[model samples]
Target: MKKIKLYRPIENFNKNCSYEILVNGKKMTDLKNGEEKVIGISNELGKLNLRAKIQWCGSEKLLISESNNIEVIKVTGNKFLNRQMPFAGGLFPLTGIVIFSGNSELFKNIGIGILILLLLGLIGTLTIWKSRWLKVIRE
Candidate 1:
């Protein structure tokens, strides 16, 4: 038997949640932030496929070959379109609430708009671009 390590590092956006690790399209384990899980592989197993899924979002299917024999896989929540814009933008409305306490109405309206946009992004990720939500790479 051989061991494959699955590691999930603490990330800024999605660190609070745990993800389901899939081995050959089956739920193998739940990985949490900064946690590592050792998966056992049979010697007779020819090819191994690993993926991470949380709700409808997931990583690209990864195939492990006997030639490379990778033992460690790093997993994390991928940024939207690999950009940091949404993360920074998401904080602006929250900042406004504290900054403009006298004008709560204005900030409330702005927050609603931002929330809607964020919801749309979540919907897109859950449906159209589900595979891009998680990043899984061999280490």
Candidate 2:
């Protein structure tokens, strides 16, 4: 048996929501924003499947071995990604439009367009994009 440290830094803008940790398709524990938790893993299991749940199909699965002393796994999500459906959906586009429209004339068309696209792409990670809302990495 071994131990793993799961951490979620404060950089995630969606502070209100917490991530549910899963080990080998079984739920282990949950971690709030800026929180860390230590959990036991079975060495016998070998090549365990580790993942975090944001809401739905949260993140990509991570394959890890239990031979390490203590693996520090970090999970993170993009900013402005904790939006609720229907309501927050409309608000996001409106908010983007407002910001784009309010920008200076010099950067209105090109700069604002690029900024809006970037933000939309990031937000899409939670939905249509191939990437997930949360990213899992080892430190």
Candidate 3:
């Protein structure tokens, strides 16, 4: 991922300022005034010089005005998942369990209810894993 270091020259305007980081004129994040501490971008965006603006200012240090048309620099780096293994070992056992359960006859004579329960559990686990991985990437 690329690392962009931005310095906001304006200070004491209020902690509640609405800041935006725009890459080549595209908006990335709309953060709370206080939340405007530091920002990072993915490597896909490459080295970018962004235009930032303080869109709003609120009462107290918690309230600050937005910045406009400010230029910032970005440094390029390796891809975010470059260090990830091509084959993740953690998914093997789960895959085996899913494949094994598809042949229901192996668990026959035990009762349809038991098989249904096992299938439901496997489905739930896969759903959770998928959602969790998606969340990690999104952040």
Q: Give per-residue CA lDDT, model 3, range 35-96, as digits (tens).
A: 32345555454444454444321111111113333323321111221124223444545545
Report the poorest 10 consecutive residues by lDDT, candidate 2.
78-87
- Candidates 2 and 3 compared: the better one by TM-score is 2
Worst 10 residues of 1 by lDDT: 80-89
User: Could you tell me the C-alpha RMSD of candidate 2 in Å?
Assistant: 6.5
Ranking by lDDT: 1, 2, 3
lDDT of 2: 0.76
TM-score of model number 3: 0.28
Error of 3 at 12 (Å): 2.9
lDDT against the true structure, each candidate: 0.77, 0.76, 0.38
What C-alpha lDDT, on a 0 to 100 scale, does residue 127 get in candidate 1? 82
Model 1 vs. true fold: TM: 0.65
Per-residue lDDT of model 2, residues 11-128, tens digit only: 6266888888999889999999899999998788778989888667578899887576898999998444544332454555555565577646754555556667756865775468
User: What are the candidates' C-alpha RMSDs?
Assistant: 6.1, 6.5, 15.9
**Candidate number of the best TM-score:** 1
